[model samples]
Target: MKRFVQARAAAFRGAIGAALLPLVLGGCATTGINKGQINVISTADEVKMGQEMSAEVAKQYTIYNNAAVTAYVQGVGNKIVQHCDRQDIEYHFAVINKNEVNAFAIPGGYIYVYTELMRDADDEAELAAVIAHEVGHVAARHSTERMTAMYGYQFVASLVLGQNPNACAKLVTDMAATGGFLKYSRKDEHEADELGAKYLYAAGYDPRGMVDLLNKLKGLETTEPTKFDTWFMTHPATSERLARVETEIAGFAKLTSPVRNAAAYAKIKAQLPK
Candidate 1:
């Protein structure tokens, strides 16, 4: 099984490299985001790619079925999205039924949080912190940027165009099995932390929620390392990230009142599987 998976991953990588060779050699046209980063995939194509990839994700993992729990997550995610940098695409949020403590965003605006992460959060603000960070990745176009840098723009555009279904499926499959093969860099992780704090503050959630969530993860890293393996695979060091989040929160102007919404979140938590 391991050899078969490795073979599929290698084949997918080779296929993408071959398909994108021309665009890489000739240099492709790029689009700009708020962060001034260039992306080879346009917004429309990004959304299409996300829709396609999300379908594959749905096949790989079971989405949490409780409407109330899912709706609560969407509500928090929407609140953060309102204050995000990109508004071109509609954001979709869902909870995965998996027990692993992780959250991830795909090419477009689709963000997913795991049930274990939700159950672990102390309040709504902490949950919002994770969602905002994922939203930050979306706003900054980190996924497509990383994809463009790794696979080349033409290869990703081909996925958007449905030019190679087998390669696309293999790519998503490898990502799922490996806890996200399309991992972001340390720079990308820091930028997302900064942006998440900004959104958390602007959305009327206490900016400290970001700090608290990072600290919680840091503790989990020390105590229950296995639960955080997938999260740490995608996200870099929690201690460093927590320090940066604290610095970001320190810069925020004091608001009259900030929201944590612990009570509401507790109700939502009760609805999760025990």
Candidate 2:
């Protein structure tokens, strides 16, 4: 009887392995933004990481509180998100009270823009371009990919798989200190710019807005170095980015009469603390 039971258990184990073979093979196949990339981090973990990092950022900076301005930013962000490819994830947008002319996106969909960046935008389209660029970063899973590359995939996987909140928080915070979350490689930036323009065009916003913002930042790189420093200090806008964005804009020529929404942007700009 014991020998019969042992044989049955062995057969069961083999059957289980056979059943799981297809699943294992499917998991190995690449899809979406993770295609051709070595991303071991799962989607749920990416959202958790963004939530933790976003909370940390909120603790460090004051969230801007102007009702109308906040609403306007959210409106623009929402529109771009609707046209984005990664609709499976929820997106969060906020304006920080800092005067820095910069914006960043964490894994998942946490995107933040500084007040001065919004205030400095030439129009609603420019602001949308900035938000869309960050969205592109999130949509592309750049941060998760970056972390996977920086820290080995196994190391990142362990924190997420451990299912410990504190461990996940600590891992994200440590990455923040290393400037891992703050900067993207120039290749990443180019990808973001191109993707941002594609989103802008899809959302009926002129893709030229991206080109305009890049030009504005490049021109500011010399004249008002200090003010521009707020943005360039962490995220450097290079000549290559400008050229790349311009080329991207050119591709959208067939997109007819994209909305610039200048007057509405002026009204939102007026609400900012002067």
All candidates' lDDT scores? Answer: 0.82, 0.72
Model 2 clash pairs?
none
TM-score of model 1 relative to the true fold? Answer: 0.89
Evaluated against the true structure, the overall lDDT of model 2 is 0.72
Model 1: how far residue 83 lies from native, Å: 0.7
Give per-residue CA lDDT, model 1, range 1-274, as digits (tens).
Answer: 3445445545556666666566556654444245344455778898999999988888887888899998999999999999988888999998888778888888888898988889889999999999999998888888887776666556676798899887678767767765653667789889888888999999999988888888887888888888876676677788888877887788789989999999999999999886
Clashing residue pairs in candidate 1, if any?
none
- Per-residue error (Å), model 1, residue 139: 0.2
**Cα-based RMSD of candidate 2:** 11.7
Worst 10 residues of 1 by lDDT: 29-38
